[model samples]
Target: MSAEAPARPVGSPRRPGVKMALLAFCMLVFSVDYNIVYVALPEIGREVGFSAQSLQWVVSAYSVGLGGALLLGGRAVDRLGARRMLVLALALYALASTAGGLATEPGLLVAARVVQGLGGALLFPATLSLINTGFEEGPVRNRAYAVWGTAGASGAIIGSLVGGLLTDYLGWAWVFFVNVPLCVLAVAGCYAWLAPDARSGDSRAFDVHGALLATAASTLLVYGLINGPEAGWSSARTLTTIAVGLVLGVAFFAVEAKAADPLAPPRLFGYRGLLTAMLIIFVFQGAINTLHYLFFIQLQDVLGYSPLEAGLAFLPMSAVAMLGSGKLLPAVVKRWGVRGALFSGLTGVGASMIVLSLTMSTDTGFLPLLPAVLLWGLFAGMIYPAMFMAAGSDAAPDEQGVASGLTQTSAQIGGAVGMALLIAVANAGLDLNEGAANSVGDVVDGLRLSALTGGIAAVAGAFLAFRIKPPRAARQDGSATEAPPEPETVHSA
Candidate 1:
């Protein structure tokens, strides 16, 4: 065990249900915030003067910050304590939400998003660490993770609906404003149910160099990707930025190799299934985020759907996703194992994206989109929960926190890079010059290419999912230990 996490003391029973709920809520906020700003992009642009291309920053900024800090935050959770970090993250979330809601300019709004993403980065790893550590490893932990995954999927749907309602009825600002009360409630839940961290006897120094190198590498890479298409990809600035990012990435690994107290300790990567899990997560999350980003824009920009209608269109899919994650996934994992579940889910998601790519039309209504949406959700439910379980629990028990952060970091970085690539593909032949005449055909062309790119990525994820091996079951000597008793906290379905 690293000199960070200490074992829970004997006889102080934990409230597992309450713990799951609180952690799930935090996860919900992360997923919800990801897509909440999506539906409001049009409104946000109108009010704050964001061009179509410039609007990507509003979304990418958050991911860049979140991805960059996630690993470090996870280590902090191990060293600093999950409860303390989570409480602070929640407070930061509330403040960031307020700042975002009140922003009058594009820069301010993006800055606020960065802050919000940072909060999410810290909160995500801590929540997963807590869940992994708090629950005994078995069926109960699996179910808890499934519920947690369900909350995140459902939150994505809720975000779209909430964003639409608030944007249509109130204004775009309310989308950000709504998070304040919800975060406060989450903070309260943290205090009420979360167990205090058990401190290690030995103290370890923070790996500041590792953190800086990792963060700079990721940020530079994302910035280059996002900016590449806008400024000619062959331009010196774009090339130099990308090269610098690569160098930083090399430096980061080197730092990790020699550091006495590395942020991502070497032992964390020694686990069998972790590398495969992280790779699968990177591609899968990237594809899903790309789908959401383009689908929303396609609905509004091409089909001329109102925010409410577009949001409503996602309701059925969200419900299906929630059901799959909450109920169907646990059963599938039980029968097929984690790898089997992942393969099945990835196949569904990949097929859905491919079908959507082939079927998308300029003149179509909501009906054409329904089949793909439903398929994506159904598979996603299985994929998300299984992936989380595989990543968070497959590692040595002490390294669960690092595993959680690494998985999430892969997800955020993948989403950011995927969006950039798709955006670049979509915008290839379009006239994005300010005050230039634009046609709906140009937009449709971009959307079609973007869908195709996303489909290919998802299909690749399915292929990569095959690499994940099932976690090894812990061995027992002679007697089977009975599972821990459930706590008396209110349970979510």
Candidate 2:
């Protein structure tokens, strides 16, 4: 029962395709609620009597639970065994979904969502770690991570579409209930094909204090940020919550630096390109999450689109993204080194943001926005897969799970922060526009200004990518070569 640093030789030559699909499916299931619920909200609200402010709690709870606990989730996988955590989390997710879907009151539903997030936090990192267990580094792992990243990118479109249809034809409750069977199928598939491993000395000791402080701080901060839109930013509760969260976060860092078994290893920070990629991920993920909301609002309020229309508008992006990742990214990586491939892809993302910023008008149409969406699809396809490529390549086999989870944690935090900041800014501008312009068009203009903030964020991420180093596999000289099979899925894009 020692940790094996070796890659275990391509996993028995059984095609691997089916197992990878199951891994992707399981990981994506953890996230479906994040996007799907938005589509179901109106119907759920009508039945359950949730106020708008309270609805935000359902979303925030998920983000907080997942984002806050991701580091711990990674460690838990190492300690509790990936198979065990994944099984328990997936089953719990189904139960929680049922609770949320069947709840009689708004508060109960929100509580269900909180549990759902906790399950997701545990499940997602375990899924990625399982992929690491099954696949060797290099092309196999790259392809898997590409598929994995594609699942995450496409989840919004699929979830929204499924949510809308289920809400319209069946009932909003079906959105949650649908996951029950999916989870069952995923568990059966994983158990059949994937071998499970927990890190050596898993039960030696777990990072208990580190988990508590980190989770506490992240939950509070995420809670405050999300709630601040409804609760005034300057209010005592908001400010106090933020301050306390910051204090706890700082303490968590201090603990990590000193702890014998830290939830997040300080050593990972020393990896040449790891921190830089994390920054880019943090910014990009936040901004990307807001896109669904922004598009939803714009399509409905300004373009006279319906709930389904708003959901459908993203189809092009999803299709293009699938094409780019499934086809373009691998070709690009095979041709270009990871550095060139990622740099080029991220540049494409930045350009897409510019195009989006220009056409984010009250009057813009689907046709005018086509180029932007397509470019985003193309680049984000490349960017996300590369993130896994870079991080995993940068670390040891033992570190892949933690690395993957850390990258994911950064994304969740980014999404939460982006949602909060954009909401606050948009609300502020809308108020100002209401005072001065006195029209729907004018208020829409104000919303555009707020969205411009997101564009700025993408630009910043692109700049951040400049500092991200290529993994040893992609490195030109003897110094940068990664130890075998470790370069596929842990780092940022």
Candidate 3:
């Protein structure tokens, strides 16, 4: 895959539709896995003897691994080949899921989740890269992204429901066990249908140092954030880990500036739209993830709802979101353009946040929560496609992998960071000395504050959505040129 890449051959029938669907299915699995653990966490703690304080690691560990390795995974797609990486990722996911299912201890489950996250990291970027290179730009690519976003969000929603059902009926282990069959199907599809990745002539060394530094920084920072609520924020352990994370973060940027082949190329950030979209995604995703996590905890702990009930509560919102993603978004984008769609979407999320903060209460029941949840889902569906389009709009064909990787990384990292902060806010009102004995009033107050914070963030994100502009994918001839299906070329200074 050199700069002077050969054009795609005429009359080659690679079944683009099937390929795209398979890739989207992979994204679905990744999204589902991330949320499945949320509903099952309490059950897991009871069975595995995990302390309440340490249980979050089961979730954050996966996020840390997945978010941290994303950029490197993107680079690997170009150097190692997307199809090959997808295969390896699927295999890793199957193994990790099995390990998690069989685990009897907290530590082992967390370790399995970390490995699973790494597999997802590889799959995430590679799958996106394949889409970027496979589809023709403009209508085709945009529609492909819509389907991709839909699959992912739907997966998250489905995971919520499925996790609850599996935990309630068969125990928490089935949530992990269920992934095996899905992974097997995905693996078979990839092997049978995915086209081989193009080979690049411009060979360069991988930036292992940059990758390690970035991963370490993210893991350490998240570790500190998640732990701060349990240990005092001013504790030596907390401060030390956060400080080390900051140092490593600075070091990562410095190294990237000088690296022969940086994990995140400086060129990719030159696109103003991409930068703005990434920011919007970071904040919006963070806010929503925080909201969902809080809602799950509130339902189970404060409201005393069973896991099955909590999961079922998400169905209406999920249905609305899926409808928006599959049906409404494309029409909105077509009629109002990307910016209009984005702003509209963010407005709903922001409004929901405000409504939730003001009206949500334990005694009011789930009725008070429905409007916000529905609004959040609607806005979320709108935001994902718009953000993804904006992020990759300005990227050259060769840069698509990193661009996609960067966006996904930002979203994941943002969600983790946001969740940490909100959890800390919720903990602030708790007398941990009381442990699980905290009063409903105390819990409700924490949730109200958390909702307020999230609402503010969502409003901020909505304002930022104005910065998004539609990608200029069409040519003067009124036809979109397909991106050359070639190995993304890498260069050294």
Compare candidates 1 and 3 on TM-score and give the better one: 3
lDDT of 3 by residue, 208-249 (tens): 899889778877776776667667789999899989988998
lDDT of each: 0.78, 0.73, 0.77
Model 2 C-alpha lDDT per residue in residues 16-100, reported as the tens digit of each score: 8887887788767865766788777778878889886577666777777777777777777766777778887888888998888
Structure candidate 3, residue pairs in collision = 1-199, 1-200, 1-201
> Model 2, 59: alpha-carbon shift in Å?
2.1
| Candidate 3 TM-score over all chains jointly | 0.90
lDDT of 1 by residue, 1-493 (tens): 3224434422123666777787888889877887788779888998998887888788878877787777778878777777888998889889999999999999999999988888987888777777766765567778888888899888978898988888989999999999899899998887777766666665777889998998888778767876776776899999998899899989998999999988887766655466767888888877887787677777888898887888888888788898889988889878877888888887788788787877677787778888998998899887887887778644544465667888887777676677767788888878877788768878777887788878876776676665655433323211111223233111210
Q: Which stretches of candidate 3 lie over 4 Å from their true place?
A: 1-13, 427-430, 435-438, 470-493
Q: Estimate each model's TM-score.
A: 0.89, 0.90, 0.90
Model 3 lDDT, residue 365, Cα: 83
Q: For model 1, what is the error of residue 288's alpha carbon versus the real structure, in angstroms, after optimal superposition?
A: 1.3
Candidates arranged by TM-score, highest first: 3, 2, 1
